[model samples]
Target: MSAQDRLVGAATLKRLRLARGWSLADLARAVSTKAKELGQPLDASVASVQRSVARWESSKGPILPGDRYQLLLAHVYARSAHGQLALSVGSDFSELLYALGHLGESERRLNDLRTLLVRTATDGGSGLLALLGPSTQRVLADALADPSKLDEELLEAMGIAIRDVNRQVGSLPFVRVQLMLTPIVESCRRLLDGTVPDAVLLHLRAVAAQAYTLAGRAAFETRDDEASRALYAAAAGGVGPPWRRAVVHMSHALVTLYSTPGIEAAQQLVDAAVRDARAGESVMVRARAHALQAEIAARAGSARHAKAALALAWYDIDSDCDGDPSPASFSAAHLRGFEGLTELYVGDPSKAHDYFAQSAEALHTPRERVQHAIVSTDQALARIRLNDPEAATELLHGCVDAASATGGRVAAIRLRRARAYLRPWRREDWFADFDDHLIESFGA
Candidate 1:
């Protein structure tokens, strides 16, 4: 470590605040917001914020408030100075460094993706996208200063790879896709800073958005809620068409739902999705969207609306599910699982139990697939409500391996909830055994 390393924590905070032209008060407010999200409401009074900001920036106060705080801080600074940020807070957040480090990995990914494309890209990476039509070279941009022109084909190839990659994310390793695409997204953003053809520029923007979206999906599946939200927001900026924009909004809503329990915020996202979908006119998008809408409506104390939206979702499921669904389309099993979830949220665990059981029966005839882990956990939740605690325990034990493999954090959340439900019976032998299993599947 160098001399500057000693001062990293305070200096880093000061620098970031300055870069954003934020005062001590402004920094305090942002910190307060982060704190609120973590369920620690800050005073936010000018006096409280100013003093806290001073102490934090000077290292005179707690540099890291808590593990969750540090993780949230890492997320807030995820896009800029991520290396320095990581080094500064390294001691405070060793377990969470992987989340922050991925930010830097995006920059390095550009070269790696280029090499990969040159060697073995199937279609999207085939020549990295070489498409030419009706006099596009002549329809140039006034934005171009004619510097060393970059390869449009290569950039287009990167974009195609991003869109194509989303199809496989459901089956492939989420971590691998996140690592591969984020860097390409960053490279696309860097390229956009330079002059390129208007057509190429627009194409680059769209691809970057999609890359961010795909990367966000990976982050979400991995249970990195805050990072997923930020990535989705970045993706939302470059959305061009109505259908894509609708998907972006819907995706943003999905992340928001996962991150917070605030019904108002969830409603806002649903409304945004609805507004964007009007132009797209796809029953498929609307269908998938209603599944979310059902969840939000259930959470909002409107069982009638939840049921209505879920019915619409069922109607739309087959509209575009005939072998060639869009990247965001829901399968019959997914819709059924949501139907079960809506029942769970709408105060009917018996119906929820039946829905989840039916869905699981259809989806899990072979073996407990990784993708079904969350659904299985949902089934377990319904069992908890059904007073079949032993059955709930058995289901969780069966699904733990697959659930942890797919999304450990979500699995942990479900397990944690199960543990809480079983708390009153902790004295029982079987309950004690189930408690140990929860500890094993998740952690204490």
Candidate 2:
């Protein structure tokens, strides 16, 4: 068959629709309806759609609407099962979306999809892990003036979409997720003015809080301290589920991770998150809060507080390893890397060495690459503290490449520390090479 005539593997499409309990006919109806709605010029009469779906499933011909309906396909197949499947539109999906009145939401969805697909492939792992169901806890409808009539299905779908966005974090750019949140927040505002049930209003608040949290992180990653702090507070305000509120505090605490003089404030924020996590009985979240506590304590030059926080972190993490992995990245490897970080900054270099060595080997997941890159820089830092310039140079090269590639904030902060160490070795030829590469990668 010609390239356009060939099927895209019916099993992939079938499995996608089937996993969501959609029948072949149901799939055709959805595709056609969406295409028609978007004025995509579809002959979506029941009979035509039937023939198309049949040919697609039988591998006799390419599916109709599937060829040029890249966005539609994304809506159905963005989740994992077959793979991180999506077709390039040969043009920016954003422009077409703007024309079709889906600009922000499309940017959000496609960017999240890109984060899940492109970033993971860049990192390493099974590539584009499964898309979990949306939270069903919230929904928003922009331009829907009578959103009071909004049904539960759409609300559930938004909840799921929020959940999907959750998966893309740490694996993708924060700005990508950040763009789509404003519309949803606006929608939530409109819905709040409507006749939503008491329960649904609560769910909307929770999702709004989450939207705020994601936006806050994006701001934090870009080093916009003021915006990050403001967004985090917005996330905590108003009523929401306890678990989600707990995360807000944790995310807010992380805002201080790179601040040399903000350790005291960071500790207070983390302590607040820890208290909320404890109240919500969110043990894993508590573990993360403690880990941040340890880091902040280390930064403040309080070895006792750091050590105590580290111990509690281990206890909480061990207490809940059997549960589902977090929607965000917090692998055991990262914990070790965090430990190595604490050691390098607050304890002995020799001790930091062993933790980073193990952490590096375990840093193979798609979500862990940013942390992987951050750890590499810190490992270089540890080597420098141990007076191993050559060893440090080798590691710093990889660190620079990884950070530059990901626009990693953590890597940027670590690079400042690495520069200080390298300056002392400026007379060495190896230092010259490292300095030249650093300039090339990050621009002096």
Candidate 3:
């Protein structure tokens, strides 16, 4: 069947009406009244309008409303769903129809969908380059048909898109970043299906590897460690530079560290990442790899080893000239956070608090919400260790606020850690408040 013959629009309209507990006749009357108020009076009587509404919401005769009727219908539900969909979708009737069908009765989903559409429109489909508009679709179609058309410029553009999405992983909402990265990763997979010419094969693989690595990060942000591991493995299989391989190895190690009980396996992966970094002469990668190594050592309660790794990490970071790329990039603040964790693990609450404070101060405002939340929770844990449950609870509330908006799994994990540390004071009023807020924001 043709696209126009689909019952998607009809089903959307019916669901929207039913969700409000409104009948066809009620919707018709509402639309008629709204149209007159909006200075576009419907000439049809209420009975006629009701019949039209029924037909509009019918599958047998799936006909879209005219522009005037659409406007009238939107205005009728202006305070609710349809009107908001119209405003967000603008004059693109097809998009409006598709969004209506896609979102169903979830206002939250509608808002998310609106943000995605607006970002796609304003950002020139930067993250969604694979699903670009007609012109780009045409170009991609030609490239897919004949591999030579996947030129260097296009490959570079794809690389930039991958980097852009990678940068959004920590800053943007997890769901939004996941949504943006999925398509790029899928597109890269298709490109790497053995069709590209030998001239650009390695370059294409490099870009594809970057895409997979970033997607792995997105999955990790959502706490989907299994998927994250698979994506990182796919990235490692692709032919890329030594630095890129280091990034993939480090990413895989991170997921393994958190998700599995295989500490030795995680250590081996991070060790490989460190070697790759040294081979590539990337001090930045070395810094990040060592930071991960320090964390692993700290988690294993090897205070001496952890401190040694942190010292090496600090030295590498100081000597680093060029910064790392988005997917596996490390900043001074990140190193400090790792230092804070190491100090806490080593039974130095005061030192951990000092490191976390420095990290918090160094973080970029508004853009580092997730990182800030994680740091706050870690600092709170330090406060708990210092016999200050009230201060820890206060910090946890702030973490809850941050996670409520961004749905950051990293922040949630830190919050869980803080909660565990506060278990001794769980019966206290402040602890109750913190625990209740955590459950409400994240879950039990």
Best by lDDT: 3
List, residue by residue over 139-200, the lDDT tens digit for candidate 1: 22212234136456655545555554553333344665565565565665666677665656
| Stronger candidate by TM-score (1 vs 2) | 2
What TM value does model 3 have?
0.69
Clashing pairs for predicted structure model 3, backbone only = none
* Tens-place lDDT digits, model 2, residues 158-247: 555555555555566655545444455556557766777665666666666766787777677777778778778777895465656678
Q: Give one digit per residue, the lDDT tens place, for model 3 in 211-276.
A: 787778778878887888888888999947788798889988876776778699899999899888
Give the TM-score of each candidate: 0.61, 0.68, 0.69
Number of backbone-clashing residue pairs for each candidate, in the order shown: 1, 4, 0
Error of 3 at 327 (Å): 12
Candidate 2 lDDT score at position 139: 29
If ranked by lDDT, best first, what sequence of candidates would result? 3, 2, 1
Q: What is the full ranking by TM-score, best candidate first?
A: 3, 2, 1
